[model samples]
Target: MKDTEKISLLSRLVAMNTVNRNEIEPAKYLKQLFDDAGIKCEVLPVGEDRANLIAEIDSGSPILAISGHFDVVAADAKEWATDPFTLTEKDGQLFGRGANDMKSGLAALTIAMLELKAQQVPINGTIRLMVTFGEEVGELGAKMLYDAGYMQGVNALMIAEPSGYRICYGQAGTIDIDLESIGKNAHSSMPALGSNAVDHLIRVLYTIKAKVMARAAGLHNAVLNTDTLFNIDVFNGGEQVNTIPNHALAKINLRTIPEVSNAEILQIFHDVIDADAAKYGSQINMHVEMDLNPVVGDPQSKMLQLIQRVAKPYLLNAKFSASDQQQNQIVTKMLGRELPAGTIPALGAPGGTDARRLLVDQPLGFDYTVFGPGNFTSHQPNEYVSKSMYLDFIKMYEELFPAYFNEA
Candidate 1:
């Protein structure tokens, strides 16, 4: 596929409002693209208006698996300079909702797969591409595929997760928590007559925050660096100003390291919520929206060594990160690269990815790496990816695919 074709495909993908919750149309489109090229593709049904596209180009055996998410979180186009659904190219950047988050990576991989097929590149193994749905919503499609044995024979996984060309060898785990409180509604003027759900929920939230923060303190990991980060990202309470709210909701996000188990941290939340509920005399409910384990992939994998060999010493430049400079220096030195003062990508992802399923859970026992043209500005409004960076990513994959298959 040409650069123009790849850009055209990405534009069409951005135009579709396959909001993280709805990815069926885009999945179908990908399947059609594959079918036209005589590649075997399957639109694996997920849920309503959502599907995962799996396509394979056979060489001899299945080995390396590459994946990306087509579904993007809902975008508030009102905040964008142009329609978020319409891919806009301005000053060498392609602006759109999923452009940076992952759609660009998806496009690059698809184009690479097509080029490989067209060139009839000989390989000792097959190349599998998975365009999954709901990566933004806790990697639902990846979990589904993993459960269905899609990762059975894979040897390695290369995920295009927009790390600005840096290789991500590990990903933090995640626990999505929701806490709610129920009380009796009454006029705002008569505070004594009704239990304020909002007040009760807020009290519980503060307490939980303190406990979570305390739990995160002092612990550390060599790869992720931080112990754990927790935040109450979403909160909802009340309907009208004149009446006291009878219900309240708070959603918490917990990014975990490998040292702690999901269940252990979850229980701490449960205990805190239970205590607060009884103290406030309100009915409270807690829901675990999603729980994924952390995965530390082999940083010394031959796949990564091969990529760095081809990309060069420039790929080793350090990207300023929130992580401490000492930690960054340590990791860079470990990779057998001299640390440069120049900007580089984060050593590890602070948030979760489908890697929680692909690598941590041992579905295929595969080593994995994530690198792409996309960056951290993924879910924000007016997200974009540079054309040069995007094209470079495609070229990287093009070079890596044959080298990887032929070498190993």
Candidate 2:
């Protein structure tokens, strides 16, 4: 498709209020689009109108699944310079909630798949387009797909997550622990008569911070290039000012690497909490609500190599013509011109995505990597994506996937 047409489609996707609050509209739109393209579309149920979409150019295995998440983080309308729901163009950037975080990536990949089908490119294997919901929350949709056996026997899974152009081979794991402290309540005036749960929680936080952070400093993983650390991301305490709070809840988020097991990590937290409870005479309870193990990839995978061989050149050369190369050494130095600097994308990603749930926990074991038009601006105020970047990514997908499937 023409670039203008592609941009128009992306703008429409961004215009949709699929801000992860509801993904049904986007999924329905995509289903119709796939039907028009004569591709098979399936809806996997998650909630009412909160379903996941799977549209496929099902040729045969090994399937190369091109995936994205339709659900986006909730965008506050007030924080944006332009309407977060409306795709606004200013200074070559499109400002919208899901513009950078995903919708753009999703649109680009979807367009590529449509184009491939329209062209009737002879496919050697299947090219599946999978989009899920609840990614921003906890990858609930992706986990459901995994449970239903939708993530099996895929040779390679390419996620259109926001990654700039970073070909991620690995990513950090996330573990969320919900902790609560309950103590006897009394009137505030009687200070010593009742234990303060909030105070007890503070003591626990200080203790765990010291222990976990210090332990984190010592524990390192090469892929994550950092130590696993914990943070009290969500905390609730004290219902009234006049009474000593008898209950407090704090949720801890930990970024982890492959070396440590989730069970072992939970045990560490329990050890700290149990010991402190006995000493402080306060009731402490811990439950790990989420455990997403890290995804470690083989940098030497053929899929990654194919990406370098094809897409890298396209990105570098997109801005310059051969005549411009004659102005410089862009062709090569094999005594040749410097062909666009061939880049092997970053071997891993720092943040987590559905890759954690679908691939790490995906039973059939799909080799997964992440790429998209996402930038640092995602999940922040005034989120925007460069129109040019989105265009480049779509073009890359167009050229790369066919070669990947056909060559394989």
Candidate maximizing TM-score: 2
Per-residue lDDT for 313-367 in model 2, tens only? 6556545323323423421231232233555454554588787887865412246
Model 1 lDDT tens row, 190-238 = 9889989999888888887787767767787667656788888989999
For each candidate, give its TM-score against the true structure: 0.82, 0.87
Root-mean-square deviation (CA) per prediction = 4.9, 5.5
* RMSD after Cα superposition, model 1: 4.9
**Clash number for candidate 2:** 8
- By TM-score, how accurate is candidate 2? 0.87
| List of clashing residue pairs for candidate 2 | 330-338, 330-339, 331-337, 331-338, 331-339, 332-336, 332-337, 332-338
- Please report, as a residue range, the 10-residue window in candidate 2 with the lowest summed lDDT: 330-339
Error of 1 at 5 (Å): 2.4
- Clashing pairs for model 1 are 61-126, 318-344, 319-343, 319-344
